[model samples]
Target chain A: MNHKELIADIAGKIDLTKTEVEHLLDIIVDVCCEQLEGRGSIGMQSFGVFDVKKREERLTVHPTTQKRMMIPPKLTVNFKQSSILKDKLKNVPS
Target chain B: MNHKELIADIAGKIDLTKTEVEHLLDIIVDVCCEQLEGRGSIGMQSFGVFDVKKREERLTVHPTTQKRMMIPPKLTVNFKQSSILKDKLKNVPS
Candidate 1:
């Protein structure tokens, strides 16, 4: 599902219009980004946690060129499924 | 941040009350999970994508007992950050 579909699905379940749901989604994304950019995490019970992890710089050599290069340390966002969600997924026949 | 604090933060930024925001969040979570439970994905432009991945069952040895065991296959949720968000994070000083 894309953004529009997700928004429509959400709006359909609630009393808000599509536009209002879209706005709400945008705000939620903004808030999440702000929190993650600060290296913090967002935890929702029975849902999951969104966290920011920093990958340390490392040295690697090109496979073909055989040249060494430095990879700068960078930040990344990770989502860990909550145990509750994990259990729910486990219960589904794979 | 915890769910309550996150909800309050979002509520403060929008016209919606805390209760309304909480309800909205719940529906969003539910929709996302529903999509994921079907092994589908949700893509939010300039934000990221949430996908369901399946890890094949594997055999492993117990560390202390040295006994072999079978690990069941499981479904997991993964979030891949968008390049826009990655760039934004890169701009932040480490």
Candidate 2:
């Protein structure tokens, strides 16, 4: 489902107004982004752990030209599913 | 960070009471689990998508005895981070 649909579902399930749910969702997204941008990680149980990983600069060969190229250091976000969530999903029917 | 610490952080950031944050977190976890168990996915923008994936049963060799064994079908939860979040993380300093 998309964002609107997901928010609707959350509101229905929680008996909250759509506006309130949307506001809260926005806050959650903002908080997560801010945390990762500052500390490189946000740990939440049952949901998952979001972390930033860095790849150092490296020399790589160009496949076609056979020339060496320097790849710049980069950062990436990684998500590790929580074991509790994993176990729950494992039993879910397809 | 652990669950409690994470909740505390969320509460502090949002200016919500710890108890309220904990309660909402619990509800979120319950809703996600219930949705996955009924269907197979929960899609949330800005956060990520949580979906159940099935691994079909297969025959595998036992390394020690070299005997064929049947591997049962398995389900797993997969998370695909959103591009927006990925970009934010990529710019984060390590």
Candidate 3:
């Protein structure tokens, strides 16, 4: 499901209109980006934690030309599934 | 930030009341969970993708006891950040 579908599905289940759900989703993404950029993390019960991790600069060689490229350090968004969520997923029948 | 804090923050930025934001967040989490449970994936631009991955059962040796453990096959929730989010995080100065 894409963003629109998610919003639509969620809106159907909740008491909010499509527009409200859309705005809520937009705000959520915006807030998460801002918080992560500010070095803050988000934690939700039974879901997961969204964190910003610092990655060091690294050198990579081009696969085709054998040329080296230097990648700069950057912050990365990392999500760790909660044990509850993990358990819930793991128990699903194949 | 925790769930409450997230709801509070997002509510402050949007026109929705705190209660509405809280409900919206709850629905978002619920819908995502249900979709993942059903082996569906959710993707959002400039954010990330939430997917369900099947993990095969594996044998692992205990670190200190020299015992082998059998990990059962299970589903896992995987999140892949979008390229736009990645670059935004990468450009942050150390």
Candidate 4:
């Protein structure tokens, strides 16, 4: 489902209008992004954890040119599914 | 940040109260989990994609006993970040 559809679904589940739900979602995304940019992590008890992972600088050979280069260390967002969601997805009984 | 703190952050940015924000966040999580359980995927334009991936059953050996075993096929929640979020995370000027 796309953003609108997802928001509509959530709106259906709760007593909120679609627009209000959309705005809230946007705010959630913005807050999460800002937190990640500030080098923080967010954890949802039932969903998962979203955090920034730092990659180490490493030497790598170019696949085509065969030239070795040093790739700078960088940050990327990572997520680990929570056990609740995992069990739900796998349909395994806890 | 924990769920409460994150919701508080979002609440500060938007008009919603902290409690309302928490409720919305919960609704979001519930909807997403239901979607995944229903074998569906959710895409947020500015954030990322959440989808369920199916793992095929495979044969593997236990390292300790060296006994062969079959791993059952299962479902997992996977996420792929959007370019917008990735660029923000990498600080790429685009």
Candidate 5:
């Protein structure tokens, strides 16, 4: 669902107004971005863990040129879903 | 960080009490789990999209036995990060 619909769902579940839920969701996104940019992690129970991982510099071939190029080290965010959530998804009917 | 600390972070940014934030978080987790179990998707802007994918049933050899076995169809959840969030992560200092 889109942001507005999702916020409405959250508002219904949490007994909060749509505006309040949207504000909270925005805060969540903002904080998560800030934390990951700072190389930190955020764990939400029954959801997943969001963390940053740093990859080492390496050499890789340029796909089009087929020539070796230096790939610089960089950080990336990874998500590991909770086992409970994973199981629930696995059993979902198609 | 763990669940409690993450909730605190969210509460700090949203100006909500810890209890209220915790309740809201719980609702989010519950709804997400329910949605995925129903083979639905939830997209949280700046965070990521959570959705279920169904894999076709197939025949595969057992890892140790090397005997052919039929693998049943199953569902899985996938997350795709937003490009803006991905770039923020890629530029994080190591």
Candidate 6:
């Protein structure tokens, strides 16, 4: 599902208009980004946590060219699902 | 930040009340979980993608006990940040 489909799904599930839902999502993203940008994590109960972690600078060889290169350290966003969600997903048909 | 703090932040940013923001978050979680449970993925523009991936059953030995055990195959939720988010995260002080 894409953004529009997700907004429609949430809007249908509650007493909110599509525009309102979209706005809510936009703000949610903004808030989460702000938190992550500051090296903070967002933990939503029964959902998951979003965090920012730094990757150390490292040397690597290019796969095709087999050339050595230096990769600069950078921050990354990561998400880990809550245990409640994990339990719910345990029985998903493989 | 926990769920309530996040809701507060979002409410402060938008015109919505705290209760409404919380309800919206609940519904959003429900919808996302439903999509993931069905082995589907959710893609939000400028945010990130939530995906469900299956892990093949495997065998591993306990670290201390050194006893081998079988690990059942299960579904897991994974998130990958969008390039826009990644770009924003790049300059984060490491």
Q: Note the Cα lDDT for every prediction shown.
A: 0.92, 0.74, 0.85, 0.84, 0.81, 0.91
lDDT of 4 by residue, A7-70 (tens): 8888889887888888778878888888888878899979999888888889999999999999
Put down candidate 5 lDDT per residue, B1-94, tens digits, no spaces.
7899888888877667999889888897887788778777888887778777777899999989999999888777777777888787766668
Candidate whose lDDT is highest:
1
> Per-residue lDDT for B32 in model 3?
88
lDDT score for residue B4 of model 4: 82
Q: What is the DockQ of candidate 3?
A: 0.71
What is the per-candidate TM-score for chain B? 0.95, 0.86, 0.90, 0.87, 0.78, 0.94
lDDT of 6 by residue, B1-94 (tens): 9999999999999887999888888889999999999999999988999999888999999999999999999888999999999998987878
CAPRI class assigned to model 3: medium
How much does each candidate deviate from the true structure in C-alpha RMSD?
Answer: 1.0, 3.5, 1.9, 3.4, 2.9, 1.2
Ranking by lDDT: 1, 6, 3, 4, 5, 2
CAPRI-style quality class for the chain A–B interface of candidate 5 = medium
* Model 5 per-residue lDDT tens digits across residues A1-94: 7677788888887667998888888887898888888888888888888888777899999999999999888776777788878777665556
Q: List where candidate 5 sits over 4 angstroms from the true fold.
A: A55-71, B54-73
Cα-based lDDT at residue B34, candidate 4: 86
Tens-digit lDDT string for candidate 3 (A1-94): 9989998898899778888878778778988988887888999877899998888899999999999999977777888888977877765777
Cα lDDT of model 3 by residue, B1-94, tens digit: 9988988898889877998777767778888888888889999878999998888999999999999999988787888899988777765766
TM-score of each: 0.96, 0.74, 0.89, 0.84, 0.80, 0.95
What are the runs in model 2 whose C-alpha is more than 4 Å off? A54-73, B57-70
The prediction achieving the highest TM-score against the true structure is 1
Fnat (0 to 1) per candidate: 0.78, 0.55, 0.70, 0.69, 0.75, 0.84
Which run of 10 residues does model 2 chain B get worst, by summed lDDT?
Answer: B32-41
Candidate DockQ scores, in order: 0.82, 0.48, 0.71, 0.53, 0.63, 0.87
Root mean square deviation (Cα) for candidate 4: 3.4
For residues A1-94, write the lDDT of model 1, one tens digit per residue. Answer: 9999999999899998999999889999999899988888999877999998889999999999999999989999889999988988997777
Q: Candidate 3: list runs displaced more than 4 Å.
A: none
